[model samples]
Target: MKETPLCLTVGHLLPYSMTDFNTTDFTNPSTFILLGIPGLEAAHVWISIPFCTMYAIAILGNSTILFIVKKEPSLHGPMYYFLCMLAVTDLGLSTSMLPKMLSIFWFNSKEISFSACLTQMYFIHCFSVIQSGILVAMALDRYVAICHPLRYSTILTNPIVAKISLAVVLRGGMLALRYPILARQWPYCKTNIIPQPYCTHIAMVNLACADTRISSYYGLFVLFCVMGLDVIFITMSYIQILRVIFSLPTKDARLKTFWTCGSHLFVILAFYIPGLFISLLSRFGQNVLLHFHVLIANVYLLMPLVLNPIIYGVRTKQIRDRLFRLFTHEGA
Candidate 1:
């Protein structure tokens, strides 16, 4: 029997099998090279022991949020319900990219299978979109609780909230899944080196030799259309919330509102502001601001996973009490 050397594409938007690339010339792919950090120390600097620590703590923290909500039935309402969903999304976000990123950085495991890349892209974008929507849903919950307190329960019942959660997750998932399929349809005639840490859709789009007009349009459409729309709705919801808070005529109420919204605003700014800068830089600056771009990217991606648990959970007394109970409960 004849023997053929195994071929695999490392890390990515679409899972391209070498067998699939047989008809296509991938060896001499065009322009952009991944330019992985040239040295092991360099990769180590980007990802160190702390990276794994942060990643593990992030997963555990977010998982604890879901566990607390489930263990206590008093948390059966819309707020905690949405919180569990947020925790689930946070876990998805962290596990999607962090483990792979840290593996590459720490153990010199830079090589990632093509399918793994696609899967990463799908989950990262899906959870990110859902996170954005969940923030919007939370804002709505606040709005109803404060502005229309009388009708809050009547309006935000379990069935209604659950349906909204389902819709948000489904919509985000569908939006993200589209790209992997789209990428597979196209040929990878360009350089396959992904300069960034993970298989981002934008980076993948940058590698294509075919006319990227559609991909570019779709990227901008998702950003300006979907992401933009989510940001706008969040802003609008908060604006109405502020108006209600101001009208309350009590300092304590206003202060409480500020505290409640503060963590979310922090998360939003952590993810969006830098993300916006990176997006514009990629499109216009030709990756000139690479260092800042990468640093800001970590802020956008990992901060949410770890910070959400600390900011939201620690701030809420119920969560603290629940944690105390979880650990202090009678055990065998």
Candidate 2:
């Protein structure tokens, strides 16, 4: 029988097999292998159990948030509108990455086409930026309600909210486009094994045989522009909110004002803390284990998705009451 080379391609878009590996020629692989948490391959099944559970709860919780907000006429305000955007963003973020991650863990299906991988990277990062923007909008909502209560409606009318939502989507989509575009241009002559389960900008850039300083700097620029500015705006709004609460001249009023902002504060911390950690670690954690980095990256993405709905559902009186009524068969 004639010998055949162990190589494959899908219209020139799949990875060449091991038989085609060449040390002398630098070329991009059409497929990349995802090593689901290197060094913890033996524990992948165990690790996936929690990840799968979180993804499931995220789906149910965010879905419930969307459904309840839509069905309740009282929740038709700007705050709830932003919350719906948040829930939708969370759903998108989780859906984009978790299914493939679970597949890698459960079925050992690690091969991902380069194009598919870049697309995944783009959506994951884009949704993350959108979620950040939504959080800022939520903070602004709380700020207006608490600080400028008389003009809250005037300032955040339905049209304004719609415009803000449009801006958020456009900003996230445009900013995140650079990642996959830059990644696509780089030559992936290095081994096509991505250390992380999902294709992150850093992970994909690491696989590039070319210089990546531009990508690295642009990532920092995004970090500053998105997370940094968002955090500053949220903090400033909350600071003003605090001033208003403290000047309310009654303990009950102050407490009530504080209570209203509690869920948003918690959600902000939940999203940003892990995110900042992951961002810093990705760029600077040379001493950290590969598996630890991978694990934390996955957690950073999943934690906000899982916790946002639970926080809002439990802390916001209307959401909590509606959720209770949902389970207990009470009136709308």
Q: Best by TM-score, which number?
A: 2
Candidate that scores best on lDDT: 2
Which lDDT value does model 1 have at 5? Answer: 22
Could you give candidate 1's per-residue lDDT for residues 175-246 as a string of tens digits? 888877776666676456665567667666655566756765666677667777888988888888888888
Residue 315 displacement (Å), model 1: 0.8
Question: Where does the lowest 10-residue lDDT sum fall in candidate 2?
Answer: 6-15
Candidate 1 local Cα displacement, residue 8, angstroms: 25
Q: Clashes in each model (backbone N, CA, C under 3 Å)?
A: 5, 0
TM-score (C-alpha) between model 1 and the true structure? 0.83
Any runs in candidate 2 off by more than 4 Å, and if so which? 1-26, 279-286, 330-332
RMSD of each candidate relative to the true structure: 7.5, 7.5
- Scored by lDDT, model 2 comes in at 0.81
Per-residue CA lDDT of candidate 2, range 30-60, in tens?
8888888777888889999999999999999
Structure candidate 1, residue pairs in collision: 11-112, 12-117, 30-190, 30-191, 34-193
